[model samples]
Target: MKRSEFIGEFDLDAVLTELSVDLDIRVTRRMLAGACIGSNPEDAYLSARELRESLEWIHEGENEGKVKLTTILSTACDDFQRCLYYCVAGKGVVTMLDDLVWLEKLLEARGRIAGHIYRNKLPVKPLVNPYVAAEPDGPLGRFDPSFAIGASWSHDPGPDYDSDDRGPGPKLKG
Candidate 1:
């Protein structure tokens, strides 16, 4: 199945939510960010290792009655493992590098599938700046420019202003 189709078929958000609620563990964006690793062989190895370790940790917690795992959670974990497997082989070497032509293809596929699962599944909200007002819609908002004023200075030069003045007041002595 296509990567998007595969992602759509599984309710990853529900699985993660179920795990978090049952385990009473907070799953923040930072935790799920680990899934984005694997740019290189070593990174991919580490990412897979981390996922495996996480699964083992969860299993241990389940066994100790500290956490609970439903079938869906288990399946989701297994799917993640499979996704990691495609990026690097058992010995931590990329599988398709021998044929340089196909390496890019493999990497692209791996990234697309894993990225969709990791990024699209997470419950992360975009951070908003409270001090700034959101731009309105339409061309006016799009064309508007923002400016920062350091200090206010009067262009009129008050009552002492002269239209043909060569300088503003007298130059300060050093």
Candidate 2:
């Protein structure tokens, strides 16, 4: 998305389709944004979409849990957003790289259908894993995951994220 564009302007299905190389899915802008409790609508929607895409491989038949992937992803997005608020509100500091690393572990555990269906539940709280050994894949400076922030995910003085000029990083409360 262009810096000039507001997040509400783009269709979420189109964004997901493009992000996934034209994979057909029925997602609306509101459904995308509805999952987050964050103040920044743009970031919330972006994070939800990314989480959805990451976990979309689980088939309905494989999912024995009452909660859907959408619901699980929504909770995950809320956790992510709460961390963003924490850092932006100056409650604590979590590096963008560390945040990504944390998320990657969540995805790793959740990628297994059995694990996702059995380990995660409704009203899921932020989870911390001790096995995140993967090195962070993106730039380590700011909250710039290409999935969430797009190309302009840097520590530049442009994006107006929750009245904090700094990039939207998350500090997960332990």
| TM-scores for the candidates | 0.18, 0.19
Model 2 spans with C-alpha error above 4 angstroms:
1-80, 84-94, 111-174
* TM-score top scorer: 2
* Cα lDDT tens digits for candidate 1, 1-174: 656554434332333234323322212211222333323323333444544443344324333221221221234222433343233222111111221112233334544555665676743232222222223222221111122211211121222221223466652210
Badly placed stretches (over 4 Å) of model 1 are 1-39, 62-82, 85-174
Clash number for each model: 0, 0
**Model 2: ten consecutive residues of lowest lDDT:** 22-31
Clashing pairs in 1: none
Residue-level lDDT tens digits of model 2 in 21-50: 312211221222222222233444444344
What C-alpha lDDT values do all the predictions have? 0.31, 0.31
Model 1 gets an lDDT of 0.31
Provide the lDDT at 55 for model 2: 32
